[model samples]
Target: MVKQIRAFNQLKELALSQEILEDSRTKGVVTALYEALKSRDAEAIQKILAPDLEWWFHGPPSHQFLMRLLTGEQESDFRFVPHSISAFGPTVLAEGFDQSRSIAWVHAWTVTDGIITQVREYFNTSSP
Candidate 1:
């Protein structure tokens, strides 16, 4: 009975450790992506995102600047300043306003294996 209990406890500890490690790895990727966005570092952005990344924007269709930034069609003149960031398992949510531009944005990211595979961005349309 004693040996069985010890074995179960060891297994539980191992599972917990693995979960923490994955969380750390996911946060690292999310943080790096935001840092790259702030600096407008195209190379860093490319490095952190998956090659086959899928991103969507929710706002007026007239607002094409954000899409341009993501597709590398145009350079970003705005810098996003995240006010709050939270991680729920492999997903990370960042909400803030742009310091360089008058835009409030909420970014939801899905990270897998240390790479951002999906992104959903919501921007305030009231801002010019």
Candidate 2:
């Protein structure tokens, strides 16, 4: 969690230092997270997620792990939705919708000498 906060702070500093530009589609992704969460739709989450994804929430990893590992619902009552978004470097912090609300997440973009090699997700636990 500290690492995530540090990364977010770094992003803020960088944004303050430069004229930041972002894609509208990325905003759509943020909205999509929200829509998905409101509906508790994993399919929606999958749609926004990159093919090679790695997600981590601030709380339990089970729901996400179950989605990836079991390929379906293990039990109901667990769900997440996305909220606002912020970009720092190659990282993205998307707030989640639901109960646990441990502050949603998604980290991506591997840089090599200043180019993105890969982008993926770091899913967060859902909350009410």
Candidate 3:
């Protein structure tokens, strides 16, 4: 019985280690995307994002800053600096507040095989 318990504990630790590795990979992909954005490298952003990327937004039309930024329609003065980032499986969550615009934003990004496939954007709102 002691041997069995030890084996179970070992398996649990392995599972947790795998989860941490996955989380790190997911976060790495999202962080790279943000780096690409910060550099305004459209080609790099395109490489990170899937060609058929899916996007959903909840906020005023004017607040669709990410999309505009991606499309080169956003004003140069605005910036999105995520204060918190967390990952669960294939989904990554990033939250930030922009004092200049008084906008609080959250982004739920789904990454697959190191490519960003989907994004749900919320601006000026609280996320549960």
What are the C-alpha RMSDs, in order, of all predicted structures?
A: 2.7, 11.3, 2.9
Error of 3 at 40 (Å): 0.4
- Estimated TM-score for each candidate: 0.76, 0.41, 0.91
Query: In candidate 3, which residue pairs get closer than 3 Å at backbone N, Cα or C atoms, i.e. clash?
Result: none
- Candidate 2 local lDDT, 35-114, one digit each (tens): 66557686775665555544333345553632443255455554444455665544445554444545455534333223
Candidate with the larger TM-score of 1 and 3? 3
lDDT of 3: 0.89
Tens-digit per-residue lDDT, 18-100, candidate 1: 88887777877888887887778889998899999888889766555656776878765666677887777798888987655
The segments of candidate 3 whose C-alpha lies over 4 angstroms from its true place after superposition are: 74-76, 125-128
Best by TM-score: 3
The order of the candidates by TM-score, greatest first, is: 3, 1, 2
Order the candidates by lDDT, highest first.
Answer: 3, 1, 2
Give, for candidate 2, the lowest lDDT window spanning 10 residues. Answer: 108-117
Clashing pairs in 1: none
